[model samples]
Target chain A: AQSVAQPEDQVNVAEGNPLTVKCTYSVSGNPYLFWYVQYPNRGLQFLLKYITGDNLVKGSYGFEAEFNKSQTSFHLKKPSALVSDSALYFCAVRDEYGDSSYKLIFGSGTRLLVRP
Target chain B: SAVISQKPSRDICQRGTSLTIQCQVDSQVTMMFWYRQQPGQSLTLIATANQGSEATYESGFVIDKFPISRPNLTFSTLTVSNMSPEDSSIYLCSGTGHYFDNEQFFGPGTRLTVL
Candidate 1:
C-alpha cells in the first residue's frame, strides 16, 4: 500500500519570507506525487505534480515542489509568502505499478498561516 | 481541467436521514471519484464510479453506507444513507483526463452537517 506523511501539523511564515511545507511518501516502484491546497469550506485545488523528469516541478500561484528520491520527499516551496496563501496543504502519492489505479493516498495535511 | 459542479452545496440533515449529493461535469469523463474530508483532515477516497459498472469502494467504506451511481460519463451521485454525526463532512467529486497521470479536477464540494 502507498502512504504519505506530512510531519508538520501547521507552519507559519511572515509575508515576503520563504515557506516550505514538508511531505514524504512510501510506495513501491516509482511514485507519483502531488500537492493540493484547500481553503476553508472549499474543495482542494491542485498545486503541482511530480510524475517524472526534472526533480523540480513548478506549479500555480508561484509554488514549486522539489522531488527527492533519496529522501522520499516532495517538499512544497515558495520564494515569498502572501497572506492569501494561508490555507491547508496536502501531499498525496500513488504507486505506479500494476496498481494502474489512480487512487491517491493523502497525508494528514498541514495548515499554512502566512502572517502579514 | 474539468468544470465540475456539486448540488446542495451544503445541508443540515437530521440523524437517520439520508442525503444524495450530485456531481456533474461539463465534459464526459471515463472515471469519477468520490472523496470525503472530515473537518481539519485530508481527503479520503470513498470510491471510483465507472460509467457502466458498480462503483469500487476503498477499504473502510461500503456500498450499503454510501451508495454511488454513475448513470453516464458526465453525471454521478453519492448517497449518504442512515446518516449520523460522524458522517458530517465535505464530500467532493473528482475526475481525471488521463487514467495514468492521475491529475484530478475537483468539484466545489458538498458540506453535510448531520444533527
Candidate 2:
C-alpha cells in the first residue's frame, strides 16, 4: 500500500523567515509525489510535483520541494515566508506499481501559520 | 492544466435526502476521481469514475452509498444517497490527462451539510 505521512499538525513561522513542512512516504515502486495548498473556503491548488527528476524541484509561489530518495521524504520549503502564504498544505504520493496507479494517497494536512 | 468545475458549491440538506454533485471538465480527460474530506482531515479517494464502465470504488466505499456516473470523458456525477451527519463533507472531483501526464487537476469542492 502506498501512503503519505505529514508529521506536523501545524507549523508556525515568522514573516521573511524560512519555513519547512515535512512529508514522508511509503511506496512499493517509483513514487510520484505532489504538493497542494488549500486556502479557507477554497479548493486545492497544485504547488509542485516530483515525478522522475532532479531531487530539487521548484514550484509556484516561490515554493520548492526536495525529493530525498534515501530519506523517502519530500519536504516543502520556502526561502522567505509571507503572511499570505499561510494555508493548509497536503502531501500526496502515487505508486506506479500500485493497483490503482492514478489514485493519490494523501497525508493528513498540515496547517501553516505565518506571523507578520 | 485542465479547468474543473463543480455545481452546488454549498448545500444544507435534511436527513434521508440525496444530493448529486456534478463535475465538468473543460477538456476531455482520461481519468476522473472523486474524493471526500471531512472536517479537519485529509482527502480520501472515494472512487475512480471510468469513462464507459462502472466506477471503481475504494475499500471502504460502496456503490450503494455513493453511486457514480461518467457517461463521457468530460463529465461525471456522484450522488450521496440516504444522507446523514457522517456524510457531511466536502466532495471534490479531479481529472487527469493522458498516460504521460501524472498531474491531476482538482475542482473547487462541493460542501454538504446533512441535518
| Top DockQ model | 2
Q: Write the per-residue lDDT of candidate 1 for residues B1-115, one digit (tens) a residue.
A: 7789999899999999999999999987777899998877988899999788899998999999999999998899999999999999999999875732568788989999999
N/CA/C clash count, model 2: 0
Per-residue lDDT for A2-25 in model 1, tens only?
Answer: 889999999999999999999999
TM-score of each: 0.96, 0.97
lDDT of 2 by residue, B1-115 (tens): 8999999898999999999999999999999999999866899899999999999999999999999999999999999999999999999999996643788999999999999
Could you give candidate 1's fraction of true interface contacts? 0.67
List, residue by residue over A30-56, the lDDT tens digit for candidate 2.
999999999987888999999996999
Q: What DockQ number belongs to candidate 1?
A: 0.74
The two-chain DockQ for each candidate, comma-separated, is 0.74, 0.76
Off by over 4 Å in 1: B99-101
**Candidate 2's DockQ:** 0.76
